[model samples]
Target: MQALIDQIEASLASRLYFLSIFTSLSLPDIAGALSSDNGEASSKKFIAWYEDWVRPRFRENVVSQSPPHIGQYIKELANPFDGESCYRFRCSLLHQGSTQHPKSKFDRIIFIEPGATTNVIHYGQINGALCIDLPGFCSEVLQGARAWLAAHEVHENVQRNLSRFAQRHSGGLAPYIVGVPVIG
Candidate 1:
């Protein structure tokens, strides 16, 4: 559970980092791309910016790879795929450049939306493509992990177990993971 907690914390930081990459705008870095007078930004340069904008589209990838121990501890996400399992989606995306599975239940996984909220993955037909909201999917994982941690926390026996586990992993005198002050 401690290790799982560590993984969740790491994932939170990682997703935030991924979020930064997702929202990054390369045009702002160039001298005159966003200038008031320069309306003729190179189309190729804009394409390059588009290339840089796509971040790691693996929030579902993480959910698919959830370990059994972690699985029991965390929230159970409603399976979203009709034609594909979570594992297959992860494999296809990781091995291939995009979600190019011909028989994929989802036509495309939505990585970036201008305004998306509510931590829920909604399936719908967009231009004949099955769309999955990336942030919403990741938000489900984050919420689940936090719920599990909170469930076992602020209790004497559980805290003791966590402390002992942390100590065992650290080999004594030091803490297991750096951020866990309760066990540190």
Candidate 2:
């Protein structure tokens, strides 16, 4: 898990935000499965893990006011990325190669590229779509996952599942491949 986090962080450091974001979104799936008694991966596990860890790190909502069609102004909080929406986003992005989701609250999700200046735009709504800071979003997920891993390091389920978790072998895995760096 730490190795996975390190790769994501390295991508972010190299300004490879898309790569970082893509992999970061998959962390909940991996960690959630590890935390489960059965050690099985599923959407339910992913959403629950994300809700408990990553969701709290995000802003409550992108827009705090009612839409124009309501005919009257009312305070409303529509969270840009709830567990379901984020899960849908992950599916759409990882499977379809796009951010558009048929069942998403927003038609699309946009990630703002990091700029050289200190001032940054981290999260907001734009044209009914969620705009997130690329680096900030990636970092939040990674940080949350790291904390979760630390807290659950000693759990029996986690320990059991970790044996199957994909990781880099410094000198390759034994009895199959050896003498070079490889991921297994």
C-alpha RMSD in Å of predicted model 2 compared with the true structure? 6.6
lDDT of 1 by residue, 71-180 (tens): 45545443444212333344455456465556666665555442555444355456656565654444444444344356545655545444433223233334334433
List TM-scores for all candidates, in order.
0.35, 0.85
Query: What is the TM-score of candidate 1?
Result: 0.35
**Candidate lDDT (C-alpha), each:** 0.41, 0.82
In terms of TM-score, the best-performing candidate is: 2
Q: In model 2, which range of ten residues has the least summed lDDT?
A: 59-68
Clashing pairs in 1: 107-130
- Model 2 residue runs over 4 Å out of place are 59-79, 116-119
Candidate maximizing lDDT: 2
lDDT of 2 by residue, 61-168 (tens): 223233555524434533457889889999999999899999998879988777765666655777888887888688668868988998998999999999998888
Alpha-carbon error at 142 in model 2, in Å?
1.1
lDDT of 2: 0.82
Could you tell me which residue pairs clash in candidate 2? none
